[model samples]
Target: MREAAEPRRVARVILLDPEDRILLLHGHEPDDPTTTWWFTPGGGLEGEESREEAALRELAEETGITEVELGPVLWRRYCSFPFAGRRWDQDEWYYLARTTQTATAPAGLTELEQRSVAGLRWWTSAELSAARETVYPDRLAELLQRLLDEGPPSVPLVLAPEIV
Candidate 1:
């Protein structure tokens, strides 16, 4: 049996607008521009930062919006994927946050993000469901719809794992 790679803990935010659209960042591999995908704002936790702290810090750094309120963890997932030049095993937590601000001026992107990230866009559930473009963690539309309709679970839900 193959041993699993150690997973890196990452904190992500499900940033919602007043219209309920979720914000996603578009990016592509540096070695393969044709390989593109959309994902939420997030990064690996540094040092001993709590999940909430990492989420908030990532949100502000990636989106340049600091006025939002961080809410509870809505979902968690274990995902393994190839990015940049390496495979990553990521244990990611999704936190809910709402913001009235629309403009994003990402000032703190890492060098990798600066090169790979194209831009950010707000997506509606319907748009996400119908999109032909790739989005990570598979069924993002369904997840967003469930969250919208049912609200956050009393306890954090473990989302289905993804390997891609």
Candidate 2:
């Protein structure tokens, strides 16, 4: 049996616009375009940065929206998956954020992201709930509706771990 690899810590932003729509990036594996999904804007931390800082930085880098109101983490997730032909185990913190900017002007995207990302879109809760394409952190629509209706949880909710 193969030993488990150390999990990568990632900070993700659930960025919502003034219209109550969430922004998601469409992306595929670097080597496999057919394997695709839509996900929140975020990335792994850099050089001892706090998750909040990483979350904000990633939001700026990935979405090109800098004016943001970062909120407390709404969820924590653990997932093991394959990307770029390699298995990745990630321990992720998902923060709730709001922005008025609707346009995207990505500032700095890693080579991997440049190749993987196809586009960005804002989706309403209803649209997300009915989406046919894959989205990470399963039950995103349900979770998001909860956030909209009740606001951020006082403590971060621990999501069920996933392996894909």
Local distance difference test scores for all models: 0.91, 0.93
Model 1 per-residue lDDT tens digits across residues 1-164 = 99976799999999999999999999999777787899999989999999899998998899998889789999899998888889989999999999999899999999998889999999999999999999976888898999999999999999889988
Q: Could you give the C-alpha RMSD of every candidate to the true structure, in order shown?
A: 1.6, 1.4
Candidate 1, residue 160: the lDDT equals 89
lDDT of 2 by residue, 112-149 (tens): 99999998999999999999999988999999999999
How much lDDT does candidate 2 score?
0.93
Provide TM-scores for the models.
0.94, 0.95
Model 2 worst lDDT run, 10 consecutive residues: 80-89
Best by TM-score: 2
> Could you tally the backbone clashes for each prediction?
0, 0
Model 1 poorest 10 in a row by lDDT: 29-38
Task: Give Cα distance to truth, residue 57, candidate 1, Å.
Answer: 0.9
Candidate 2 regions with alpha-carbon error over 4 angstroms: 1-5
